[model samples]
Target: MSRLFVTGRSGFVGQHLEAALLVLPTADWQLIESARFDLLDPASLDAALAETCPDAVIHLAGQTFVPEAFRDPQRTFEVNLLGTLNLLQALKRRGFSGTFLYVSSGDVYGRVDESDMPIAEHLMVKPRNPYAVSKVSAELLCQQWAYTESWRVMIARPFNHIGSGQNESFLVADMARQLVRIKRGLQAPVLHVGDVDVTRDFLDVRDVVAAYLLLLEKGQRGEVYNLCSGVERRVSELIMDMAHLAGVTVTFKQNPGKFRRAEQRRVVGCSEKIQKQTGWKPHAEFSETLLSVLSDWEVREAH
Candidate 1:
């Protein structure tokens, strides 16, 4: 059996990825989570690596929230940039040689023009936020290690992914949470939102995890791939769809406090590269994904 060491295994995407790996038909894989390893401490990371000695490492642990990164750029840099550096140093010290997948965000392609509607891997990255900056920096760091070491380092830049068990802090989850409350009569029949005019490419978290697995199995060394659905949907349409799924009547109210000054007007991605190479494509229906998220919120709110 091949052992895989995974960071951020308890997080939103990490949890789902773990669940997906558990039910796989092949019994040749074992997942080891880095929950016991602190990214800020190199000694702890070294000890963890020495213990697990995995055949591959998936680096998913990082500062993900944009607004939170803005609030504390230092912590974001410390965790996202310095933390990755420490991981690399520890791997070098252990003379590790295996695949290392770095999970990045589509936010790295910040402020793109409409002409670049379906952003491709060739587009230049212009990160606009602290969180995105940190991710881009880490990507460069991983590339350096890939060049210097014999390890196969790959990066997966996934677009906006949403599904069940996501925290309410995220866009779709917040909408579902509010809709659940409205349906339960616990809150007013109103949904507060921000910048609904903007459009984004939303991929189901399950599909994202599937792409990650395919990338690990077949992706090229020292290459980057975008894991996204090529379809762009407006936020306003998503809100209406969620309300319809929840069978709730709701009126929208613009929340000024929730508005982001640097929000991209439209963000989409082309997955033709990964699809052609890995033979992976998104399979979840839009309505099904929304309904699943709403249903999950309903269950959580009931308790």
Candidate 2:
């Protein structure tokens, strides 16, 4: 049995990943709870590490919301960068010789040109927001540890992943929530949307978690991988699909408040490297994923 320590176990992606790990039929993997551990507290992190002695760790805890990061960049940096530093320090003090995976974001490739449609791992990182900047900074820190401390570290840059239990702060979840309300006759048949013209690469949260698991087993140390669908999908298309799934004819009204002035017009990624290394590919159908998200919102709205 191998012990695995996972940060942010209660968050959206973290929750899905923990669920996947439970059902996976490989080794007997045990999870170390992060509930009592605070990333900003070195003592707490050290205590958790000392108690668990994990064979591998998946770092998922961070200030994830972009708008929240914008509202407080200092806090974002403290949690993302300094928090990562403290974790590494604790592990080093414990003389850890295990695999560590840093879950970064594709937002690090902020505001890419059309020619950079399929952003690769080699593309220059141009972070456009505080959250993206923090991720990029943390990535650099992880890479440094990999090189200097001889720790087995890998970074994953995942694009937008949607699934059940996701808070409505996200774009797709917000759309699904509105659609659910409309379907239940609790609201009008009009969906307030942001910039739907922009395109993004989205994968199911389940698929994303699977890729993370594979990377833990097969990914090369100090290497970075992109976990994405490799398909550029328009937000408008997703909105339409959600509406159809909810059996509602909805009209969209552009919400200026929801729009991000620095948003990239198009963002896609190439997952070829990870596929070649781990033989991992997205298995969820787009419509099925969409329907699942809608169903999740329906359940939430009914309560």
> Candidate 1 lDDT, tens digit per residue, 84-187?
99988888887779899999999999999999879999999999999999999999999998998899999999999999999898999999999999988999
lDDT tens per residue, model 2, 113-177: 77877999999999999999999999999999999976789999999999998999999999999
State residue 265's C-alpha deviation in candidate 2, in Å. Answer: 0.1
For model 2, the superposed segments whose C-alpha errors exceed 4 Å read: none
TM-score of each prediction: 0.97, 0.97
Candidate 2 clash pair list = none
- Each model's C-alpha lDDT? 0.91, 0.90
lDDT for 92 in candidate 2 is 87
Error of 2 at 207 (Å): 0.6
- Model 2 quality (TM-score): 0.97
